[model samples]
Target: MALLPSTRAITSSAQALDLIPIVNSITSLLQALNPRNPNPKNLSSSPLNRFSPFLDPNLVTIVITKQTNPFHALFFFNWASNPNPNPKNYTHSLRCYEAITNLLLHHSLFYPAINLLKKSQKLSDFFIGKIIKAYGDEGNIKAAIFWFNQAKAIEKDKYLYSFNSILGVLVKANTIDLLRTLFDNVVKEGGFQPDVSSYTILIRGLCKKGMIESAQKVFDEMPCKPNSFTFNTLINGFCKKGDMESARGKVDEAKTVMSEMWLNGVKANAATHLNILKGLCIAGRSAEAIEYFRWMASCNMDLDAKSYIVVVNEYCKLRKIDEAVSLLNGMCGRGISLNVISFNSLFRTLVELNELHRAILLLLQMPQIGCSPNYVSYCTVVCSLCRTEGRMREAGYLVDDMLRNGIGLDATMYGCLLEGYSEAGNEEMAMQVFKEMIGKSYVIGLESFSVFVKMLCSKGMIVKAENFFEDICRTFPAVERDGYRKILDEHQQITQGSIKEHQGEESS
Candidate 1:
């Protein structure tokens, strides 16, 4: 095809008018390639008739990258690939295969994409790596490992990077033993030199599994010196474990490692200090954590949201609400945006103090500050209101708001609301809540169901209560029907006895 005339200039209006035919030619060519066209074969064939022009690797890239309707382009590509109705006359180019692979991955089209890769005649190391990564991403560890082994046997040198990718999958999959086997034998015995990334992956995996000692051994065995990321990973792992005694030891280790890095001309960054502060906080040494934060600030370290949340949470846990709020204000004043964790910490504390009005106001203000209320925030406030007397109405309003905003109503919130309505003698509201929970397929536990049943029967709705029991039995087939009947009978007797006492008192 000839080049389209430049839109930039054609000397003058007269020359520009002359380029209309060329512009129309380009437009017509694109129109012919439109995948939405019923007969895509009516478009020109390939330059050598090796394939359809639409299936040309370069054209496929153009379709994906330049075309407005890539979905239609993919459909046309699939149509070209189909063996029936119109068999493909040509082989797919490597770029075409890769383009389709990426397209599939973009749409999270994993299984079909894997099948496509597995069924291809030209299985390159690059395609194999993509398959391994796709399987790993989907958390199909078994598939990832299987493909990785195949890649190693087929082409070790070309697939060295695949080993690192496989290690990452194993780490995420939590297959520590298999990870070790691959690292120790396949990676080493296969004559593939394990890089720093290889060591880091193993160390982090072991730390995640609480094999901190094993992580340490791997660190010491690294052929190359550990980088800042490697040190940070180890430090963060120890902090997450939350053992005070072990944390102290890890603290000392972190210091020694920091000093060695300094001697080696690698200065400590904010991440390095943040890990230590988080460690101190988790180890119940909040005072030390605050002091470290102050020192880090004094040195002008850029504190992130995680750092602020940790300190604020520690203060809140110690019942130092004033201190926690002050720190939160300080974070905002310094232009740090509060995240969900930051808001939840203070929201919980205020609710715990029975400061419902203040808590509700803060909850409403969350979105203005770019921190939208999550399920935890809504559930916390709703559950708290449900706990207080004369606040069930307010909790119901919150529930309505939650549903409107697409926030999920979890079992804990439902249980609290059910209990509130039951205690308030609002059988109608309790029944309504029970039905909503059932409609949503929430499993009503025995305790919650008991509360609802007692509420229903006490209000003299024995038949309705019996129906509820039957429905619950159907919902939970494992629950013995006799046990439910026994509960209904007990509530029935209690209601009748109370009614008798009331009648005698009225006559007296």
Candidate 2:
């Protein structure tokens, strides 16, 4: 049914409408209606009494629809219908109920919507389905089950949608045990039969929790046929598990399903191909995975950023830098924007392969390719180069470049430079970096702090080390004190033992 014009108008209004007074009016009415309030005087002074002249049920419903918070509507509904309600003026029409209920659901006010349903004088499949969905959305498996059981008393047709909603909630919650029981109940019940969607939900939950065999069992036992989403869920589940054997098995299974889909005139789309590609990558079959990726390009399948990233990461893992770069160029030519993640993958691989120069080249080229390098991109190369012989100076230059580009030098970057300087025995530069880092927002990581302290001690600058340790204790009082305690204990033990030896010598 189409919405009322007034109802539609209020919801689309862009202004931030205030409903606090309306809510206050209704809540006050509720309190006055309560018999327990002994001092129930001045009913005429209540806001409801004052607004009664303008409180048309239809008009108030429009206001309810406009309210951002559903509680306001619930309070308004209660006030309208609860106290000495006039049949002609105060009755909540079906349209009014639907409006408020939908508004409640839109705001994710599940409990209020459910309460509305329970108190509703009229119940329908729509309201029941909404209640079940609301509970599911709340991630309240127990509440969803309670409502499902409550729905059993509802008519069979009404219960059907609510039942499916509950099952879907179970699937989302990964309540496998409850899912099994609910699936059994649907079967054991005389009239209701589980639909493809119902089975898909159960299968997806199983697959997600790594129950591949059980998911397959449910797939095989399906009385109805499965759709692409059903197949995709299982395929993606296997890939995410990262178990090579199972991933391979699932890949073959997915291929079989795709073949069946083709025979049935259901064409495999990009998502279908992407799932298989992900599985192949997880199985470490990079060669086969690239073949599929190429096939996608040949078929003109639209490849998204994720698809590019998956292929890029797989190629990087196999140390196929040239192939990965080709994919990046191909994406650019095809008008696909490369995200930071794909670039980072290439950066990581280059650094790992000890191709620091190549990694730096790519990092510099990132902005030209429309992908700005993030902190990780710069830090990965800088830290890697800092570990190499005679490359500390270059790493320091990269940090300056990062700052010139308006990318702030974070704690990790500072830590990297400090370690590099200390390792290179450039004590002056190390102390400079340490001083600049002391009061910054980025708290240095514990390991880096330890390295800085040890570097000072190893340089025979004991007084400087002591002062630095005192600064640390003052600056990061919350830092784990064990490192400080160990250092202090060692120094104390040396002093005490020397004093005892000196006393013994004096006695001799």
lDDT of 2 by residue, 332-447 (tens): 99899888988888989998889999998888888898888988889899999877877988898888889888888877778888888877878899888887888773566666
RMSD over all Cα atoms, model 2: 7.9
List the pairs of residues colliding in candidate 2: none
* Residue 201, candidate 2: C-alpha displacement in angstroms: 0.8
| Worst 10 contiguous positions by lDDT, candidate 2 | 1-10
Off by over 4 Å in 1: 1-128, 138-159, 186-192, 242-244, 400-412, 431-446, 452-483, 502-508
Candidate 2, superposed: residue stretches over 4 Å from native? 1-108, 118-123, 237-240, 400-411, 441-447, 457-460, 478-482, 485-508
lDDT of 2: 0.73
Give residue 90's lDDT in candidate 2 (0 to 100): 52
Candidate that would win on lDDT: 1
Worst 10-residue stretch by lDDT in candidate 1? 45-54
Q: Identify the candidate with maximal TM-score.
A: 2
